[model samples]
Target: MIDICEESLKLQEQLVAWRRELHRCPEVGLETPLTAAFISKKLTDLQIEHQTNVGGSGIVGIIRGGKKGQTIALRADMDALAIREDTGLSFASQNGNMHACGHDAHAAMLLGAAGILCTRRDQLRGNIKLIFQSGEEGPGGAKPMIEEGVLEDPCVDSVMGLHIGNQFHEVKNGQVGLHYGNVMACLDSFKIKITGRGCHGAMPNMGVDPIVIAAQVITALQTLVSREIVPTSPAVVTVGIVNGGVAYNIIPDEVVLIGTARALEQGVRDQLAGRIENLVAGIAQGMRGGYEFSYTYGYPPLVNNEEFTKGFKKTAEKIVGAKNVIEIAKPTMGGEDMAYYLEKVPGTFFFLGSGNPEKNADYPHHNARFDIDEDVLWKGTALLAQGAIDWLENNGGPA
Candidate 1:
């Protein structure tokens, strides 16, 4: 035990500074140039070796250990949402973008872990990959990074990552929430464009009314899970955006329906896309309307390896207390690009509850006013650092 907790505590001020500084000037999507540069500079200051511009604006830093062992990766997402900052903190973003989902804290904590691990490179075990990824909020960064071989070179044996926030209500403040399997749902999206002849509102019968067709399509889309899928399975289909009609009195030529679908199981995930397209095609054709349907398979369901999660649960218990390590009763429908990394490697993604009513940090993720409790920041650093150390020690070959 290298006193990672104490080391993390000592680095608390630095963590707060880095987080708040990153918070002040947030960036968005795949073009996180400033954020990347900041991360690169911090890695450089720690005297760590790294590569830049990986998978969009992502960065990868390598910390080789003193002895012959295996490789483990610790990941951190460094993108912000498009929401404007409303959190009244002094270091809040003045720029148009905001770190509404606590990515700033994630990046800062990984940076803290990087500093700690770099100092202990001669202690024992193998290597650690410090993955500072961009574009987790939109066009995914993990897939491109994997395509570019971030999991290669040294070749990672196990991976570990954590998310900070009160995204799950049962996860109490400062608690580490863990799930054995199916931690999150797949993030899949679909779009449908219904074409009908423009007509006056009073005489919908005179022309093929797209509004009527679209309404039926929307209503029926909901039943895909309620009626078609198994009742016990967790799935969701939500129409977030519906675009049509510019004028009040005339029916539009076309109505575009865009929505997201989430499923925990691959069988169900595969089924949703085909069924949605078929449903739309049938409804539009029977209603005398034409439709264009496109379904995009986004991040796969985040399924944690039960064995790896058991190991990480112990690691988390050591850093915090066993009582502080909470087991999530079930998975959430929320989607995470972290799922992509887990898909390629045997890894686990856990949550850190940073919500506190006293600190007023309980705002929902993606909300403009969302914030995280700064006190538990170091615990995150300790968890990542210790997790890599422990996993590599046990699985790091005949070192």
Candidate 2:
């Protein structure tokens, strides 16, 4: 095996420079023109061939090896959240958006890995597909990229991706967390609209109260997880936004409730949706109000292929030492759009520990103060490059 650690260490300065540069200007959603241009420029500098404007700002870089073998893919998200930056770093974003989820680190590490893999192309046994995707925090860029045929032409046999941070606080710094199955939960969003006649506060029962029905619906939705679904199975039904009354004296004509549902198993996910619709409809009818419930299926469950995860664990252990490789005991309810890629291909999505108490880089993802330990950036680079090399060398062909 190549000395991935040494190669990655040699490029640590470059990786940090790239990460900070991207951090200064954060973009959100699928329309990431600047982020795409930056990634394209880096790939061009490396002499790596790539396709641009893929799935609305996504980029795909193709690095062919000297020896012929099956193609493997490595992915990184490129979009930031809509949150304002609060890290207070000199390189922190000033555009009102933040890389609170460590996507900047993900992109920089993948670029570092691409550079290393490009230099060692002659030593590689197969091709490496570098996927720089956008819009992971929102409407999702993976499904559209797949529709654009990012996985075709070269035909990717297996894939791998990583996230950086203390998303799961149980894992420590320098550790790589892996799980065999259901690494991340499936995500589905719901919006409930209840309509009722407007009435004055002075009157007791003059009009149907949609706000009261919405409150009941929200409370009942919680029981779907705690009472309806099996205790061993994980499920979540949270009402994040509730809008109803416009004034203290008058009840509004309509109420809107927006929230998300999450589950590890598909059966439970479907059950949650069905029960939610039924309960909302029945409650609205009983309360003499009309309602509309819209459930949109987002990303599916991210299931790590057993065989690929085993191989990835071995490769990670070799790079970061077995002591730093942690096998996660349970799956997280957090949803990842990378699950869309795993749905069609065999791959594993793992997490890299980016928390450092000494450096105060231990904030959770999505928080404005969230930040990753930049020191771990090179380790992620080495992990992806070495993992892909080892998999190509061992598997030789598609699994």
Candidate 3:
């Protein structure tokens, strides 16, 4: 196995520079032209072959090994969040967007890994596919990229990806978190529009109050998780948005509610959505009103392939030490579009601890103040490169 740690450490300064530059100019969603250009430029500098404008702004860099074997892919999301920067770092984004989810680090680390692996191409046993994806925050970019044939041509046999920051706070800095199955939850968004008769608030009986119906619907949706779902199974139903009413005296004719549901199991996820729609429709009818429910299924639960995860964990232990490898106890309710890629190919998505309370870098992901401990960025790069190299060496070529 290559000394990836040493190679990554040698390029630590370059990694930090790339991360800071990306942090300064953050782009959001599928429209990540600047970010994609930057990544393409880096690949060009590395003398690696890559294709851009894939699946609407996604990029794929192909690094072929001297000794032909199987193909493996390493993915990183390149989009930023819409949140304004509040970290007060010197390199904070000036475009009113932030890399609050450590995507900037993700891109930089992948680049760092690319640099190391590219130079050692002769030593590698198989090809490496570096996937720089856009719009992981929402409106998923992974599905589109896969549609564009990212996994074809070279035909990737296995895949792997990682996230930065303390997703599980229990894991300390420099620690790598790995899980076998159901590492992340499936996500589904729902919108409900309740329609009723508008009338004077003073004459309560004159109006079919949609607000009241919406409130009832929200309360009833909670029961889908607490009552309908088995207690042992994990599920979440949250009504994040509710809009209605016009004035103190006048009742609005319509009320709109939007929220998300998350579940670890596919059955539970589908059941939750079905129950929610039924509850809302039944409640609107009971209140003498009409309702429209729209449910958008997002990413599926990220289940780590047991075989791949075991190999990844062993590779990670080699790079970060056995003591630094932490086994994840349970699955997180949060959703990851990387789940899309894992669904198509055997892969594992792990977390790299980037929190350091001493430097005030322990904020949770998606927060405006969120930032990663820069020192750990290279570790991520090294771990990814090492894992890919090891997998190819062990598995040889695709069966």
> 345, model 2: CA deviation in Å?
0.6
Model 2 steric clash pairs: none
Tens digits of per-residue lDDT for model 1, 1-399? 459999999999999999999999899998899999999999999999999999899999999999889889999999998888998899989898999999999999999999999999997589999899999988899899988889999897778899999978888888999999898999999999999999898888888889889999999999999999999999999999999998988988999999999999999998899999999999999999999999999999998999999999999999889998999998999989999888888989999999998998999999999999999999999999999989988887776
Residue 322 in candidate 2 has what lDDT?
92
**Candidate 2, poorest ten consecutive residues by summed lDDT:** 390-399
Estimate the lDDT of model 3: 0.92
Candidate 3: worst 10 consecutive residues by lDDT? 390-399
User: How does each model score on lDDT?
Assistant: 0.93, 0.92, 0.92
Query: Clashing residue pairs, candidate 3?
Result: none
Ranking by lDDT: 1, 3, 2
Cα deviation of 181, candidate 1, in Å: 0.8
Cα deviation at 298, candidate 2, in Å, is: 0.6
State the lDDT of candidate 2 residue by residue for 37-124, as single tens digits: 9999999999999999899899999999988888899999999999998888989999999999999999999999999999999878
Stretches > 4 Å off in candidate 1? none
Q: Which candidate has the highest TM-score of all?
A: 1
Candidate 3: where is the Cα deviation over 4 Å?
Answer: none
